[model samples]
Target: MENKTTILSLFLIFLFTLPFSAQESYFPPEGEWETKEATAYQLDFAEAIEFAQDNEYSESRDLRQAILKGFQSEPYHKILGPTKKRGGPAGIIIKNGYIVAEWGDTERVDMTFSVTKSFLSTTALLALQQNLITDVNDKAGNYLWDDTFEGPHNSKITWKHLLEQNSDWSGELWGSYDWADRPPSDKNIDEWRERELHEPGTYFKYNDVRVNVLAYSLLNVFRKPLPKVLKEEIMDPIGASTKWRWYGYKDSWTTIDGLKMQSVSGGGHSGGGMFINTRDMARFGLLFMNNGKWEGNQLISEELIKEAVQPSKANTNYGYMWWLNADGPRQWENIDENIFYAAGFGGNFIIVDQKNNLVIVTRWLQPSKIEEFMQILYKNI
Candidate 1:
C-alpha cells in the first residue's frame, strides 16, 4: 500500500509540471515590452505583414491579417493618465499624415460618445454646401421649427449658432438626466416657439439638447430623416459599412437598429452611444482627409468643409460642434498652422493636420479622464 501511494504521488507531480504552452503570449520576442515600458518603437510594415501572416495575430489567420495591415505604420504613443482621469482603449497613428502607433485590442469596438457631434456637424455642412439644405446663416426657425431659439420667430437661431454650441435656446444643459429634459420629454414641432428661455446666439453654453434642436431643424429642411440623408450623402460617399447603424427616437437619426437591420431617426444622443468598428471609422477619417471629396467625385463641397472645420467664435476655438486644435502650440510655427481636430468624450479624436499632411484617429475609453494617455500621444507623436 505504501509503495502504491508513492507511485500515485509521483504521477500527480508529473502532471503538475507539464507546461501548457498555449497560455503564453507569442509576439516576436523583440516587440514584447511591459505595457507601461514603451519608450521608442517603430514598425516595419513589410515585417509586420510577414509576422502577421506567419503567426496569425488574432484568431483569424490569413484574411484578418491582411485587413490588419493598415495599422502597421500607425503611431500612437502611450501616456499615463493623472490618477482616475482619462481612461480608455485607443487605436492611434499617423497615416498619409502623422499617426498614433498603438494597436489596442484589435477586435474591440466601443461607443464613440460625443464624436457623434462631429458627424452631425459635418453632415449639416455638406447638406448646406450641396444646396440640399440652405446656408448656415439661414434662420433655423424659419425652416424647421415654429419658434425662435428664444421662442417665437422674432429672433431665430442660425446654423452658425448650432455649430458654435451657442444656439441660445432656453433648453437645460445635460444634468445627469437624458430621459426627461427641456427640449422636453414629449417632443412637438409647434411647441418649439414657446421652448425658448433665452434669445438666440446671446452666449455659448454646452448643452447637447441644443444639438437635438438642431437635428429637428435638419429634418424640417430636408423633409426626411437625418440618417437617410447621411447615408446617401456622407456614409455612402466615404465607403463606410452598410452594416453601420444609428440609435435614436422615432424621428431622429440618433435612433437606429442593428446589423442585418436598419432604422431612420437620429435620436439617441441628447449625448452619445454610437457603436462603430475600426474599419468603418478608418473610412470616416479617410473621407475627412480627402477633403469632403472621394475618388473623382465631390460629395460634400469644399466650402462648407473649410468653414465647419475652423474655429467658430474668434476668442474660442470651438467650431460648429467641433473643437479647434488651436489651444496648443502649432505643429510647425512656420510650415503651416491651419490644422485642427474633432474630439469626442473618452479618447476618440479625429485629428487633421494639413500642415504635416497627417490625420490621426484615436478611440479611447471615456468618462474617465485620460491625462496620462493624451500626454503620451501628443509628446511622442
Candidate 2:
C-alpha cells in the first residue's frame, strides 16, 4: 500500500508537468510546424482574429500602383527593383512556439518593405559578434575606406548612427540621391537638395539612400551577399522556408574579391527588399522571442539582441531598425512598452511580445488599426 501511494503521487506530478516541458522543448523541424488549439492554452483569441480579418489594409492588392501613388510626392521616384501583387490579409499567432491561430494564406510570399531593415541590422550585429566590426561607434568609413564616406560630414557617420537611421549619410547609391528620398514636403527640390546637413547621430530621418549605404557597407564587410549570410547563419537554423528572397536595385552590383555581388536594399521603398511568407516571418519572431536562441543553439548573441531593441538617442520609439513601444509618436497606447516589432510600408509586422511569450505576424493589415488590434489581442492573451 505504501509503494502504491508513492507511485500514484509520482504519476500525478508527471502528468501536471508534461505539457509545460513539451512546450519548452518543442522547436519546429524543417518543413514542418506544430499547431495547438487555443483552448488548450486557455486563450480566447476569436475576437482578435475577427478584428484582424475585418481591418484589412485599404491599399490596392496591386502594390506597384500603391507604391507609385504613395511616393508620388518624392521627385524621381520609380520602381527600380521588383514589385508583385500582394495577397489579402494574413497572420499567425504563436504561443510557446506552437501555432495557436492563423488566418488567410500564410504561405504566400510578399514584399516586406522597411521590415528588411531589421534583418539588415541583424547582419551588422553578426559582424560585430564575429569581430569584423570592432565597435559600433567606430567610423563607418574605417571599414569601407572608399568615396562613399569621404566627405567631411559623411566621414563622421558610425555603424550605430546608420543602424539608428540618423546617419544623414549624404550621397547617392544605385542612382538614388540621399536628398531625393522622402524629402521635406515643405521644401522644394532645390531647397531640399541644398539644406544644411545635420551631424550623424544627432537627428533621425528615415531615408532609404542611407539605409542602402548600410547594406553596401555590410556587403563590403561580409565580402559576400547579405542573403547568403542570413540564410546560412539565421534562417535555415530557425527552420524558415526557402521561399524567402532578398533583392537589390537593378544596378546595385559591385565586384568584391573579383566576384560581383548585389548589395540588397534595406527596404522596398523603390521596390526591393525581403520577399517572405507569413509562416517564415512567425518563425523569425519566435527566434527573437526566445532571445535569439533557436532550439538549443544561440544563433545570435543575446547581448546583441538586447542592444538591438534599446532606444536610440535620436528616437525613443526606434531601436536598431526595430520599432519600439516606448512613449513616442509611434507608441501603441495600452500596450506593454517592452514590446518591439519590425514594420513595413504595406502593413506587415512581426511583433515580439516577450512578456507574454507571444509572436504575432500580420501582413496587409491596415497600418492605423495595428494599435487597436494589438490591444484586443493583449486582452485575449
Candidate 3:
C-alpha cells in the first residue's frame, strides 16, 4: 500500500510537470507571440500578368495557374524531382502587396539561407532609425570588443562595409567544404570581428561573419539582446509573429565566471538560419510596401525603408540585406532599375516592383538549373 501511494504521487507530480515542460521554449525569457488565425487577402492572380494591358496586375489567379503549369512543365523545377536533387519547391509571387501566384509547395517553410541577410539588414536599419546607433559608418571596434589579429579589420570595417559585402574579415563566406562552410557561431562574434584582416571597404567578398558582427554591434549598442530588440521593434509590430522565431539552440544565453558562456545569438548574412512560412514572408513584403508602418505604427522610417530596398552602397545592387540587380546577364532585363529583391538559397526570392506596387516571393528546392529556372520564371512573369 505504501509503495502504491508513492508511485501514484510520482505520477501526479509528472502530470503537473509535463505541462510546464511542454510550455517551455528554448527562445529564452521573452513574451509569447500571441497567436491568431491568418486572414487571406483577395488578389487577382492571372489577368495582370499574362495580359500586359492590365498593368495593375489584376488577374492574380490566372498568374497563379501559369506558375503552377510552369512548375509542372519546367524541366528545371522537375516537379517530381527527388528531395536532395532539387533546390526546394513552390514559387511564391506577391503582386501589389498581395499573394497573386504560387508554384510548387503551398506556403512550405524552407531554410532562407542568405535572405536572412536581408532581414538582418532590416534590423540594422531599425537600429539606426531608433537612434540606438548614430552612424552606419561607425567602426566595428567602437561597439565590438578588441582583439590583436582582428583589430585592423575591425578599425577600418564599418557597419556599411559589412552591409555592402565589402568587409576584409570575410576570408571565406560562401561555397562548400571551405572556410565558408563553417559560419561564425553566435559565440565569439566579437572575437571573429576582431580577427586579423586587411583594410575594410577594400573588396566585395560575400562574408557571412560580417552580419554576425552587425548583430553583436546592435546588441551592444542597445545593451540588450538583438532578438528581443528585433521582436519589439520589427517583428511583432509588422505581424510577422507566425513564422518569425529567433534561433538560439538551448540555454541560449547564460554566464559562467563573468564570461560569455553563450557567445553568439544567430546566423549572419550570406547565410542565416531563418525558417518562416510563405505567408509571413509575403506579409513582410507588405510591411515594406506600406512604408514600414504596420497598423499605423511607424516601425521603420519611410526614408530608411526606401534606402533599405534601393541600392545605396555598391554598384552590385545590394541594399541593406536586399539584392537589387538590374538585368545582370539574366533573363529579367525588362525590370526597371528601381526593382529590388531579396534572394535566398534553393531559389527563393522576395521581389519588390516599386513601380507596379508589387512584391513577389518564390521559395523552392529545384536542382537542375536553379539560376536559369528562376530567371526564366521572372522573365515569363
Q: Among these predicted structures, which one has the highest TM-score?
A: 2
Candidate 2: which stretches are off by over 4 Å? 1-25
Give the Å error, residue 299, model 1.
Answer: 1.8
Error of 2 at 112 (Å): 0.9
Sliding window of 10 residues with minimal summed lDDT for model 2: 18-27
Candidate 2: tens digits of C-alpha lDDT, residues 78-152: 999999899999999998888999999999999999989999999998999999999999999999957989989
Off by over 4 Å in 3: 1-88, 103-107, 148-150, 170-198, 248-272, 310-314, 327-331, 365-381
Q: Sort the candidates on lDDT, descending order.
A: 2, 3, 1
- TM, every model: 0.60, 0.94, 0.63
Can you write out model 3's per-residue Cα lDDT over 114-153, one digit (the tens) per residue? 6666677777887788776678777656665534115434
Task: Give the TM-score (vs. native) of candidate 3.
Answer: 0.63
| Ranking of candidates on TM-score, top first | 2, 3, 1
lDDT of each: 0.50, 0.92, 0.52
